[model samples]
Target: MTAAKKIAASESKARAAEFPAKAGEPAVEVEERSTDGADGTRHVKEFVVLKATWPGRDEADSHKANGAAVANEAIQRGLHPRGEPRFDGAEDHPDGLSLTLTYSVDTVPSSVDHTPGDTTTPRDVLRSEG
Candidate 1:
């Protein structure tokens, strides 16, 4: 099944309880990403962007709210964004600075296909130090 289908199906039981998905509302993927430091030492950050829609609402607005929700959850779990927390002009709680989640709707036939510009950390690069 597609991510949206999976999310919607699971929503019936539980899916971001604080921000439950309304009936017929597809789950928009929210991601927090960071670049490989332009100087190869410090990463460049950007505001969180949504990759899908939230039923009948504005996609951008939905993204802002969902992104903020994700941030709040991360903070509660003692996790932080990949860089300094900054506002992205989103009017969500705390001004939508808690999290700058981004998303890339690049999926394969069976899984999520995150491309170079996708909002996902390159763990392999970080894991290799030699």
Candidate 2:
């Protein structure tokens, strides 16, 4: 299979029947997105958005920064990110955006369902720069 196809296949396997999350569990999605970088290079990535939240309503800068931290930490753990972190427009939460991590194309999620290769505190809402 080609790179894109391989990504799609892996993503489908991860989402087979893990839906309608439990009462308090955050929803997840398998994202296979590509974006062009400032240097003109293209990034092809596939990963899982384990969990997300709108943490900085009315504070655009804070939310984006916080998202960046989470994505960055995920990157350090061998996972890939779509591109530079930014706030995607949302309907339910007008003032904030989602923050999430990612995974390798062939990464099979662990039973624990935590960020891969990470053992540090969560930075999904870290105020300061990492």
In order, the Cα lDDT scores of the candidates are 0.32, 0.35
Best lDDT among the predictions, by candidate number: 2
Candidate 1 lDDT over 21-121, as tens digits, reads 22222232112122311111112234443323222386544544444443333333222323222223332334443434432211111122223243222
| Candidate 2 residue-wise lDDT at 121 | 26
What candidate 1 gets wrong by more than 4 Å, as runs, is: 1-53, 83-130
- In candidate 2, what are the lDDT values of residues 40-126, reduced to their tens digit? 111222222222533435455645554555455444433344434444333332223433322222221122346544322234434
TM-score for candidate 2, please give it.
0.26
How many pairs of residues in model 2 come into backbone collision?
0
* lDDT assessment of candidate 1: 0.32
